[model samples]
Target: MNNGAVIFAANVDRVARFYEVILTMSPVYVEPGLRVIASDRTELVIHGVPPQVLAPAASGAAPEPREDTAIKPFFVVGSLAKARDMAPLLGGFVFPPEREFTSRRFRACNACDPEGNVVQFRELLVSAI
Candidate 1:
């Protein structure tokens, strides 16, 4: 099954552009006030809704409930070098690379998105034969 995070924002177009120009992400689909930013295995969709019917809802039936953006989105990359290379493109600082607690071969860093969201990219080190 495909997994992704869907969010609602005040400015759908601006939000979409943030991911597109800043993060180097392209929209998988764009129409009807909906934008889906996608990478190889990651997707982040921002749906534009009327202000009157706006509400932040995480996992409930509410139209929208107050939600925090603290929950970061993590995407896996093939290498740390490649992920770090995106720092400039995103116009953000790479929080020093760190190894996973259980997996030393895996390294990750947090990058700030244009819309004030934190995104993480990780790469796994190949095991020796």
Candidate 2:
């Protein structure tokens, strides 16, 4: 089975764009209110926030980060160094290299998308040997 996540955003395009720039994935589908980006093992569905769910302050220009939530999706990337540099330009933030930690097979960091949805990012540390 292909593992995936569905993220809701005030601006679906912007959120989807952030993931596109950071992960090694391209959009499989796109529309004003929804987007689907996929890789070999992961897929992300970016959907527009429903009006009932949108906060009055959650404007499309700058969204409040929903940091207090419990769920945080993780993505495997090609390089944390590259993500760090690029995230800011795209209205997102990736934790600094100092915050990184290494697992048996990957180096990982925390990150947040343009709408302030918290997530984690990891890159391969070594191949199985």
Candidate 3:
């Protein structure tokens, strides 16, 4: 089975666009308050949250990251360099390379999405030792 995940947000369009840049996932389905974005090997769903429930945190300005959540969404990315470059333009922030950690096969960095939801990005270590 394909592993997929959902992100519920009050600013679905902005968040979807942010993911499109960082994750390189294109929207296959778009509706009033829902969007499904997919790359060749992975799919992610962004569902709309009730605006009254959680007011959006930011617009073009960088949001104060909300990292107090229990579950943090992670994405395997092509390059942290690319993500680092692209994230802020989309209103999100990926911590700099200097703050990364490496596991057996990947180097990872923590980030926050456009709405300040904590997320992570990982890039494969080409020469894993």
Candidate 4:
């Protein structure tokens, strides 16, 4: 099955630009409020959603916010260190990369976009190959 993900953004254009830098690839498709970015194996669909839609009700008696529904997409990178360093420049944040004990094949880390949606990046461990 093909793997893909949809990300909601407060500003489509800004988010698209941010991802373009991180992915190092231009979008294959772009519209007024949507963009489709693709890698060799997967595609990411970024959709623009207004803050009001995601915010609590205007009524004084609104329920508490619900759990987040954002889906984090895992990306493969050539170097986790470099990717982590570049994240902030591209309007994202990457925590330090660390090797997993269970999966010694790669070093992985978590990152977040400008809108606070998390994504993951991993670099294969050449020594483990």
lDDT (C-alpha, whole model) for all candidates: 0.59, 0.83, 0.87, 0.67
**Every model's TM-score:** 0.58, 0.84, 0.92, 0.75
Index of the highest-TM-score prediction? 3
Provide the clashing-pair count of each candidate structure: 3, 0, 0, 0
Model 4, position 44, has a per-residue lDDT of: 77
Model 4, position 50, has a per-residue lDDT of 71
Candidate 3 lDDT score at position 119 = 89
What does candidate 2's lDDT look like per residue over 2-49, in tens digits?
A: 699998877787788899888868899887789999888889999888
Q: Which is the winner by TM-score between candidate 1 and candidate 2?
A: 2
From the highest lDDT down, the ranking of the candidates is 3, 2, 4, 1
Please give the distance, in angstroms, between residue 69's alpha carbon in candidate 1 and its true position after superposition: 4.4
Q: Against the correct fold, how does model 1 do in TM-score?
A: 0.58
Ranking by TM-score: 3, 2, 4, 1
Top candidate (lDDT): 3
- Candidate 1 residue pairs in backbone clash: 55-64, 56-64, 56-65
Stretches > 4 Å off in candidate 3: none
Which is better, 2 or 4, measured by lDDT?
2
Please state the error at residue 15 of candidate 1 in Å.
4.8
- Residue lDDT tens for model 1, 8-71: 7655775566556544578888887799988766677988878676532222121221226567
